[model samples]
Target chain A: MMWLFLVTDALLFAGFLGGYAFCRLASDKPWPDRTQVFDLTFITLMTFALITSSTTMASAVLAARNGRLQAARGFLLVTALIGLGFLGMQAVEWSHFIHAGARMDSNPWGVPGFSSYFFLITGFHGTHVLIGVVVLLLTTLRSLQRSNADELVEVVGLYWHFVDLVWVFVFGCYYLV
Target chain B: MSSQSGVSSYRTYWIGWLVLLILTVGMVFSGAKPVLVGGMLAKASIITLLYMHLMHERRRLVWTILLGIFLTSAVLVVLSVPDGMAM
Candidate 1:
C-alpha cells in the first residue's frame, strides 16, 4: 500500500522534474551557474541532516522489529529532531536565495526559468519534508504510549526514506548538476 | 535473515549513508555532467533499495516502480526536449 503510494508520488516528482528540464532546455539564455547561486557547504549540511535522519529512521524500524521499544522511540525522536533541523536549514537556504534576488518569476541569474524551477521543485520537496517531520513526531509519541506493530514503524520509515529519496534528486539536479 | 543481528542492520544503514555522502560530495566537486548524473542515479538506487527496503520486495513490484517512473520520465524528456533544443 505504502509502496504504491510512494511509486505514484515519485511519478509526480518525475513529472515536475521533466517540466523543469523542458523549461531549462527551452530557454535560449544561459542557466545560472549552480555553484555561484548556491552555497554548497550549506546544501551539503542539509543533505547530511536528511540522510542522517533516514539512517536513524531505518534504525528505528529495526529496533521496533527487534522488540526494543525504548530504542525505537529513541531513534524516532532523533530522526524527528534531525528532520526538523533540515527544515530549518532549508528555510535558511530559501531566505538566502530570496535575498540574493531570486523569485518565482524572476531572478538575478538572467534566466527566469532557473529560479522558478528551483523554488518550485525544492518548495514541493520541502513540503514533503515538513509532513514527514510531523508524521515522525506523531509516530514517536505513539511509540511512547503503547507497543505498536513494528510494521507501523516500518511504514513511517518508508515515507521518511521516500522523502529523502526525492531530495537526493532535487539536490542532484538543482545544486550539483 | 534470522542470523542478521540489530548491530549488523544498523551498520548496513550507516554504510549506505556513508556511500550516499561520498557520492553527494563527489558530485558537488566534479563538474562533469556524466559523473553528476551517474552519482545521482547511484544515490537514488541506494536510497530506494537499502533505505526504503525495496530490496526485500517482490521482483514485480520493483520493476513496476522503476520502469514506470523511468519510462514516463524518459518519454517526457525525449519527446519534449528535442523541440526545445531545436528552438
Candidate 2:
C-alpha cells in the first residue's frame, strides 16, 4: 500500500517538476536566479537536518526490529525533533521571503513563476515533512506499548525516507539549478 | 524473515550519511553544473539503496520500482523536449 502511494506520489512530483521545466524553457522572460534569492548556507543546514532525520528513522526501524523498544522510541523522538528543526528553518526562510515582498503572484523579481514554483513545490514538500513528523510521533508512542512494533516502524521509515528522497530532487531543482 | 537479521549496521548508516553530506556540500560549491545533477542522482541512489534497503529487497520488487522511476523520467524527457523545441 505504501509502495503504491509512494510511486504515484513520485510520479505526481515528477509531473510538477517537469511542468516547471517546461515553463522555464518556453517562457520568453528570464527566470529568476535562485542562487541570489535563496540562502544556500541556511538551506544546506536544513538539508542536513532532514538527511540526519532519515538516518535516525532508519536507526529507529533497526532498533525496533532488534526488540530494543526503548532505543527505538529514543531514535524516533530524535527523528521527530530533527524534522521539527527542518520545518522551523523552512518557516524562517518563507517568512524572510514574504517579508521581502515575495508572493505567489508578486515579487521584486520580474518572474512571477519563480516565487510561485518555489512556494508551491517547497510548500508541498514541507507538508509531507510535517505529516511525517506527526506520524513519527504516533509511531514512537506505539512503540512504547506494542511488543511487536518493528514492522510498523519499517513501514513508517519507508514513508520518511521517501520524503527525504523527494527533498533531494527539490533541493536540486529549486536551489542548485 | 525478521527484517532485522539482514539489516545494515550503524556503521553502514553513518557512512552513508557521511557520503550524502559530502555530496550535498559538493553540490553547493559546484553550482549549476551538469555534474551537480549527477551528484544529486548519486545521493538519491545511495539513500534508496543503502538507507532504504532497496538493494537487499527481492529482485522483482526492486525492478518494479526501477521501472516506475524510469517510466516517469522518460515521460519528463519526452514532454520537455517538445517544449524546449517550441521555445
Candidate 1 C-alpha lDDT tens digits along A8-46: 898889888888888878888987887788889999999
Among these predictions, the greatest lDDT belongs to: 2
Q: lDDT by residue for model 2 over B1-87, one digit each (tens)?
A: 125436657777888899999999999998857968898799889888877788888778789999989888998989896976599
Alpha carbon lDDT at B74, candidate 1:
83
Q: Spell out the clash pairs found in candidate 1.
A: none
Per-candidate TM-scores read 0.94, 0.95
For model 1, state the Cα shift of residue B3 in Å: 16
Deviation from native of the Cα of residue B26 in model 1, angstroms: 1.1
- By TM-score, how accurate is candidate 1? 0.94
Tell me model 1's lDDT, rounded to 2 decimals: 0.85
For residues A1-177, write the lDDT of model 2, one tens digit per residue.
Answer: 777888899998898788788777776788777767888999999999988999998898888877788999999999999999999999999999998889998789877777888888999999999999999999887655875688888888989999999999999977888
Worst 10 residues of 2 chain A by lDDT: A139-148
